[model samples]
Target: MAQQYTKKMIRQVFVQMLNKRPLNKITVKDIAEACEINRNTFYYYYTDVYVLLSEIFQTELQIVIDKYNETLSWEESFIVAAKFAVDNKTAVYHVYNSMQRETLVNYIYNVAGNVMIRFVENVSEGIPASEEDRKLIASFYQCALTEMVLRWIAAGMKEDPDTVIRRIGQLFAGNIEASLRHSAALHDS
Candidate 1:
């Protein structure tokens, strides 16, 4: 519990600091001071600000995953994700305007990959999906999805998530399974 508290404190400090300045300008010392810990303690928790940002991304991804994995369609899941982005727009924009773009993109890649993987697994249950093929398809889908999201964020995240979700669902309707098959066929070709 104490450890959890410490981690939470660290995360809180990170959010507070990010709200105030660019990520590159915020040092481990700044985080440590804000969290009332020494640099060593900060190092014990995270190697650097990038790692800290990664942790935050994973935590947020897991929250969305854990909450709606079984209950939501892929479109719904994406809507939830967009909502998460919108809800945290301030923090996200702050991070976006920081030096953590690479870290942030990696985090989104993992999150989007996980979502695509799960969606494929559920929809393709009992269908034979080679691990390589699954990964490739997931990678493709994740890349596209992340690009869309990055654009959405860059545009100030102004569109309504439900509308965005519905449009994406319509655009990709039936293509999810078809795309997987097409990708598998291409791989096997």
Candidate 2:
């Protein structure tokens, strides 16, 4: 419990610093001073600032995943993710424009991949596609979604998530199951 609290405190301080400045500009000393913890305490919890950033990304991704798992709607899941990025605009922008952008991209890819896979599986419930086919289709959509979200963040997240989600829903409506069926047919033929 104490360890968890310390980790949380370290994360909080890092986030505050991230919002104020770029990831490259922030250091372990900054986090330790801000958290009022010693450098060894900070190092004990995290190997480096990047590790801390990765933990933050993973924690935030899990929260989004858990929330969407309950609802089980791809659109809603994306909205949750978009809202998170929008809510953390300053911090996100700082990271997005910094050297650690690949870290952010990786997190987006992973979370989006999981969400897309679950969505395809749920929607294609009655379809007879192989597991490989499902994964391929999910990967296709995951790349699209990840790129879209990255572009949205790059554009300062100006567009409303509801508008974007609705447009995406219209654009991809019925496509996952259709693609799955088509792939299954091709494999059998």
Candidate 3:
């Protein structure tokens, strides 16, 4: 009888392969061999390996977001989210170098959005900024965070992630509150 493998096992094998080789060089047959699953089983679930890659990013990043949903600190949330890429440098580069790089970007965007919204809410407790404005602020920071992570990936991630995250926190310190206060004052006037 063939052994049954869960998607988590399949995903780990796929990511391990990604760490070792570029996405373009990875084949379903190779995945099957690495996974020790029948090619038929692989085919049954995905028409293309990229489909599985996309699914892995979406599922994994969503887990990160859900896990940090209660966190009060956006910077801490970003560090945790960014750690995935930092830890999986080769795999991340493989995905970033592929045609399906948008999947990676979307994952970062989702995490950034999640953290930023929570951050804005935490800081805007007594502020009079409309929910719309608060959301706008979160969106702004989300884009910034996404770009920061993308740039780090593009630059080969030579910088220590904690240092980078800490510097960002230092640079942006009080900026969110200032932005919210400005929005409220503008709204009042």
lDDT of 1: 0.77
lDDT of 3 by residue, 1-189 (tens): 233455666778889999999999999999888878888988877778888998887777777777785544777787878777877899999899888799899988988888888889989999999889999999999999899888988998888988888888998799999999999999999
Identify the runs in model 3 with alpha carbons over 4 angstroms from their true place. 1-5, 69-71
Model 1: number of backbone collisions? 0
Which residue segments of model 2 deviate by more than 4 Å?
Answer: none
| Model 1 misplacement above 4 A | 126-136, 180-189
Q: Compared with the true structure, what per-residue lDDT tens digits does model 2 show for residues 39-105?
A: 9998898899989989999998888777876455788887776665766788999989988899899
Top TM-score model: 2
Candidate 1: residue 31 Cα off by (Å): 2.7
Each prediction's RMSD to truth: 3.1, 1.6, 2.2
**Residue pairs of candidate 1 with colliding backbone atoms:** none
Poorest lDDT segment (10 consecutive residues) of candidate 3: 1-10
What does candidate 3 score on TM?
Answer: 0.92
Give the deviation of candidate 3 from the true structure as CA RMSD: 2.2
TM-score, model 2 to reference = 0.92
Measured with C-alpha atoms, the lDDT of residue 10 in candidate 2 is: 89
